[model samples]
Target: MTTPESALPMVVPATDLPARVRIHEVGARDGLQNEKTAVPTSVKAEFVHRLADAGLTTIEATSFVHPKWVPQLADAEDLFPQLADLRGIALPVLVPNQRGLDRALALGARRVAVFASATESFAKANLNRSLDESLAVFDPVVRQAKDADVHVRGYVSMCFGDPWEGAVPFHQVVRVCKALRDMGCDELSLGDTIGVATPGHVLELLSLLNEEGVPTNVIGVHFHDTYGQALANTYAALEHGVTTVDASAGGLGGCPYAKSATGNLATEDLVWMLQGLGIETGVDLGKLTATSVWMAEQLGRPSPSRTVRALSHQE
Candidate 1:
């Protein structure tokens, strides 16, 4: 009993929704980086290839952090070279410090991301430094990357609520975001690391960021689905004029530092919603879901995405 296109339910998008949205696919780097078992370098390369084939223009390839911290991506150096031929794709890598940056630069990485925390407790736990200290550390890294013509993205974690420090103050989040922008980060991704944010929280944060003079165009949202609020929060962000949305394929990531944090908003799920809303993302829903299903098998787990489950059942 399929409904005809003309008879299907109509969705009136909020006036603020952009004509096109940039999906920042963080599956390879952010997704796999948190897996307990290390993914094979060959499989990782194939993952990136499949994502690119699915028309994800901006895919985060890998992280250059020390293997001691994120052993799941220990093969970052080996995995990067295999992706050299992805033409017209922006493959950004995560670099924790100058050492990580050096490794990425050596691999000819054209784009890199640095991480910061909006909460002092998370900062101390995640980076082993205070918020100010973490910003200082990334300053040189961003500067060096920009000087080398490499694009830089700054990630501000725990933007909505912190586990240790509940309901993080608006000023705290704004300060970190401003610091990242001041450090010359080309873009900033506000992370709801613990997944406690509601639409109201998201809207409030965006408003404050706007009030602080952070351009909406350079802002992105990364939400975790722990409490099933990721999509709701994402919609809130989109309605507030955020053009960039970060998602992981198969919903394959969680925060190591924040134990309660869950997998990210699945790319398949986000794509389904975006396409349904007539928002252009240039991602093939069928292909992206197939890729996630394949990757899930390789990991011996079912994908965490509801859209993937529904689509797979149809087959």
Candidate 2:
């Protein structure tokens, strides 16, 4: 006997969800690198260690960019070596240029990420180059990293919206994504740098990328929570077959280049939703939230993550 449609239970479509989602924790590098005060190298190492202890397999450790640009991460050389012995964790460092790649390679980095902007305004503001010019600069860096047998992740920022240029076109984002993939990037992460994307926009962009032959499996989503749409956008991406999602512990960092940008989607928050949805993330929420609370105390501020705050209050 068929029940009436109204009597059917409301359940999330199983076919629309992934069995396992990989949460790429970026709090160490993307989170702390934007802070005004410098974090001690020891504390940074401890933070990474704690995240690993919480079963976060992929933790972005640090960036090897020029000290003049991101002085907060000037201790990358000292930091990378300390994390070398961490078992079962993939530590990816951000390399802005060939020089940065050389520094990372010298320290035995196994994975590195290169960034590119999807809009001309962001390119000029962040990299001091035009859109095409920035991609040109990252070309050799990606190639060299590939030659060194180091995995490379390509990040395209300002994918949905830009502070200087409003409402970026979908084609512009796809072009950059294809360029990154063609340059040997093992995976491409689309960044909503200013955090203005909605779920509708995310679905449209991912759909367009799929139509253009970009494999959704090799694509990741990086969202900021400025507009409170990060989680919604992430859900949309996951529905579209994107399995990798970038998040920060405690919602730690924002883009310095994009002033209006806010903290990233918190890893704890993401985990909470994923766990409720029956998705396997291999993370311990208790330990992850505790780590965020500890880091927040070190920073002398409360965490922006709602899950962390609620869990901390309960404790």
**Per-residue lDDT over 4-23 for candidate 2, one digit per residue giving the tens place of the 0 to 100 score:** 34422343436559989999
TM-score of candidate 1 relative to the true fold = 0.95
lDDT of 1 at 200: 93
- Cα lDDT tens digits, model 1, 1-315, are 222345222565545588899999999988988887889999999999999999999999999988888899889889999999999999999999999999999999999999999988999999999988999999999999999999999999999899999999999999999989998999999999999999998999899899999989999999999999999999999998898999999999988899999999999889878877878899887788889989999998899898888777623
Candidate 1 worst ten-residue window by lDDT:
1-10
* Global lDDT of each candidate: 0.91, 0.92
